[model samples]
Target: MFDMIIKNAKLRNAKDLVNIAIKNGLVKAIERNIEGKAIKEIDAMGNLVTPPFCDPHLHLDAALSVGDPRYNMSGTLLEGIQIWGERKPNLTKEIIKKNAIEAIKWEVANGTLKIRTHADVCDPRLLCVEALLEVKEEMKDLVDIQIVAFPQDGIYAYKNGDKLLEEALKMGADVVGGIPHNELTREDGVKDIEYVFELANKYNRLIDVHCDETGDDQSRFVEVMAKLTIDNDMEGLVTASHTTAMHNYNNDYAFKLIGILKRAQMNIITNPFDNSVLQNRTDGYPRRRGHTRVDEMLNRGINVCIGHDSIMDPWYPLGKGSMLQGANLLMHYAHLSGYDQIYELYDMITNYSAKTLGISNEYGIEVGKPADMIILNAKDEMDAIRLMSECLYVLRKGKVVSQTKPSISEVIFNGKRENIDFIVER
Candidate 1:
């Protein structure tokens, strides 16, 4: 007998309805008109059934910490950093684990099952690192967590910050992280990138840097990262998150940088929701959007992913840990609205984000893969994005983790009864 069976669901490319059977936390079969007696079965009612979302960039340590030290009145990146600094000292294991667990619950409830979180390692105590490590284990059955030893305060700026990063990796960080643009000087920033490569090589960890997260035209650490990736031949293992400076760079320089990035096979993550608010603070009129060259990067064959960086945190002070919301804002802000472009945008949160986290091999909804997927109350890809579709059911490892219901309303119009379930087919 099957452990669970999902019936009458619309898969990604199948022409007709299919039934997915799961047993022992693995997708056993996906066939038409399958006869099975399972412990549980869900009728999808012709809604879309696809893989769960993958959030490649987020700060779990800082998540759910809004208004703790104080609200960000200036609405600038530096102000947010200051606020986070004031709040970081009081971080205990219990408090960090509580907030991190709460954030993961929000993500799982919204159909996000995989996340790459940046844990701040600027403090010598490594309290955030240790707490998040515990949180990772606690939530492993429901979510896949990849922690990065993030030096939010700048690796070279803080005393023994580099050592702290190594310690975090030793303690069990999946990736090595850096914030080079936040360093004291350009030289120091470059040095930090070198140190990141060294640490990753030393620990055999992945490299994901908060590179060039500023709007300054001179912040060229992303280029440096790309060059380093190429020089070290670490293709696909390096990700440059929030390269907002690419939007401000002159075409001459950016055009050249894009080629280098393409050659390096580096991945780019644009947090449109948070970056649009945090960046370009010093600008006056004709302000910039404070995002990376997503279109250009994709055109050059570079993998670009989108992420919800902050969730009601000090950075932007508002978020819900939903990748759909992130994809929606990104489509509008990046002007990716074409039919094909919208489909690609969908991949940004699902497949491409998995690629960014280096977890594509274990993600997706195909048979024989891990039975982690979500059923949405929408008909097609566009319908999901257009409605910001709620996940009717989220299954992690073939177990139901969260569920929501679609609303139906009937109204009498012009002496006729009308029913609306907001189901749109494309």
Candidate 2:
């Protein structure tokens, strides 16, 4: 007896299909054939079944706020920030909660069951923090949400910014976040990292900083973060998101910093969707890379993950709330198109992201792990990314939370009607 049984499922990279038995909200058995009777059963039909996707970085508070007061005229990061600042004052608790929940629903529909969202806490009112806390609790059954107390303006540059972030943590924000690269001075940026590390230590929380997100080669705050992480013995608990500046760093400096990142066990999160547009805004000409050295870091065995970062927000005007879309973009941006590298891209959104969120223990679909997974229309990871494959079924705790059909197209070929499945055959 089981809660649900999924048959003929193609687990990632597996050559043969296997039956999965779910019981007591956990995966009870997985084998070639299983004797089972359950209230519900799923026929995967040799489609890919993977652990639900996890997005470790997103701004829920600012989601769906594109062109609210005005559009980003310059299409630059600074302009986007200014537009977001204008919209912040008029935001109410009701508005934030409504928009965030809608964004969460979009992600869930795309098979993202776990997320780490940054709630802006630069305002003394802490409106975004309050709103997202409520969303986290209300949506607990629908998704696992971890709220980060993000100081968007600057922890040290903005007056009382540090205090407001602390208040958000006191009000139950899960992770500590900061933006060191945006500070007024290089010294201020250093202090920003120090303060973020101090607060993270004080609160016994994890750190996720927007460090060196700019294209300027001199924005070297990521080194400061790594050093502080090592000195504080907080290795593996710190993450530096959007280190796009690393792409402009010289080979020697970049190599040295990568070593330090390895020693600190710091997680690096590259937001392809947001940074691909935001970075290199100030560049005049020549080869200007907007992202970090992802291929090099992946080759170095550093724990690098991907983030969507923005969704129809001021920073990014386009988003369909799909991690596969993000990964597909990354596959091109990071030059990860080889057969093995394509498989690795799938891990970036799931396993690597789970590592960033510190949820590896309960994040997978193995036996004894929670029965939370998604059945994709694609038979493998390559098709999943190539087609942005629809998730036919999404389950949480052994229950079907969402289900849908993949798009199909019909056309007359040689006087006979045929279907386009979009399956790239070998």
lDDT of each: 0.90, 0.91
The collision pairs in model 2 are none
TM for every model, in the order presented, reads: 0.97, 0.98
lDDT of 2: 0.91
Tens-digit lDDT string for candidate 1 (247-274): 9999999999999998998999999888
Alpha-carbon RMSD, each predicted model: 1.5, 1.0
How close to the true structure is residue 230 of candidate 1, measured as C-alpha lDDT?
85
RMSD of 1: 1.5
Error of 1 at 101 (Å): 0.7
Off by over 4 Å in 1: 409-418, 424-426
Provide the lowest-lDDT 10-residue window in model 2: 281-290
Report clash pairs, candidate 1. Answer: none
Best candidate per TM-score, number?
2
Residues 108-169, model 2: lDDT tens digits: 88999999999999998999999999999999998999999999999877789989989999
